[model samples]
Target: MAFRQTVGKFLGNHAETNENHLDVSLQTHYYKTTKDRALTVLRNFFEKNEKFRINAVSNERGEVSASIIKGKKAFIVGTVIMVRPHQTVVDFSVTTESAFPFDFGYSTKVIHRLYDHMDKELPTIPKTNR
Candidate 1:
């Protein structure tokens, strides 16, 4: 089982876009929640998962970096910024670790999974200030 999982992780290979970097910005989501709250949500989500280990978190800056090693090793870096009162922007970067030259959309899938989690966690999406 462990060997199968490890192989699955290593098989995560990407195409272009500069090797193994996958970055994405969630459509501006306005929330009634504060930046600290958002950061907490992110931290808690990662902390609850045994596959992830948070390396750094800055409440003041609203950014976090975590390492995930379920089958393979990768870093999950994200930022939550307050554009206006009760309006925030969240961006994430998932860089997979693999011996292969590229990831076959595994990194992107990871980001999409996180987005789904956030959507469920923060159900109240307010109108954008912009």
Candidate 2:
């Protein structure tokens, strides 16, 4: 079984007039793991998970782009960085394609679900030196 926890700060959220989309970004809570391991775990999750399809990836840049085309279409891009030794930061930007002017906070829910998935999937360690 995977351990589940919500860890991340919502950076911002807004709608793009040009594209008619709602998007939000979140900074995951600090993790005591290497950048490579973090990126690989996310990549594997996105690739194998039925909900998401890996669109593009750059291991060197620590980025992964994916899309979920279920009930609502969403484009997701995640970036991983090692801010401190054994501490990795993963940022995610999720954009949902919608026709309505407002999504009734649907975009935010998507981000939260994504974070939940990460919390369960990613490795866990003692929250020390944070």
Candidate 3:
């Protein structure tokens, strides 16, 4: 698996007035498994966030688009699963076009923790088989 990280601007009104943009980026991995399994993990994570809403779901393309709204501030996150017979990787991002009057560090940390929790919790198979 190949992973790349880069900072870019988010385009939208969700950004804060002072900063009005975010450093958009992602951490990706190549897994030796099926893509559907990986996507199930990601989907479950976003579903846990009450503020997050799924704007789209496409199983054939293996993509999910979602957004989180807090007051007037909003953040958009999306993930796409790329699968081959022997490998899979998820590409994802979090972005906001506007900067609200809030702590960027805290906001970003919260989002990061949610992502981490999803990565940790969603992928494992249940011990009790149906």
Question: Each candidate's lDDT (Cα)?
Answer: 0.68, 0.65, 0.50
Cα lDDT tens digits, model 3, 2-120, are 22111112212222111112243223444555777766776776687676777777778877777766543455444445545645655554454344543344334535565566557
For 1-130, candidate 1 gives per-residue lDDT tens digits of: 2565446444654211221223223244445567877788889999999999999998887889998878777788878887777766666777888887657667767777776777677754644334
What candidate 2 gets wrong by more than 4 Å, as runs, is 1-27, 123-128
For 59-94, candidate 2 gives per-residue lDDT tens digits of: 889899888877777788878888788878777777
Give lDDT for model 2: 0.65
Runs of candidate 3 with Cα error greater than 4 angstroms are 1-25, 99-111, 122-130
- Each candidate structure's TM-score, on Cα atoms with residue i matched to residue i, is 0.73, 0.71, 0.55
Highest-scoring model, lDDT: 1
Among all candidates shown, the one with the greatest TM-score:
1
Worst 10 residues of 2 by lDDT: 1-10
lDDT of 1 at 34: 70
**Alpha-carbon RMSD of each model:** 8.1, 9.0, 9.4
For candidate 2, the C-alpha RMSD (Å) to the true structure equals 9.0
Worst lDDT run of 10 residues, candidate 1, spans 15-24
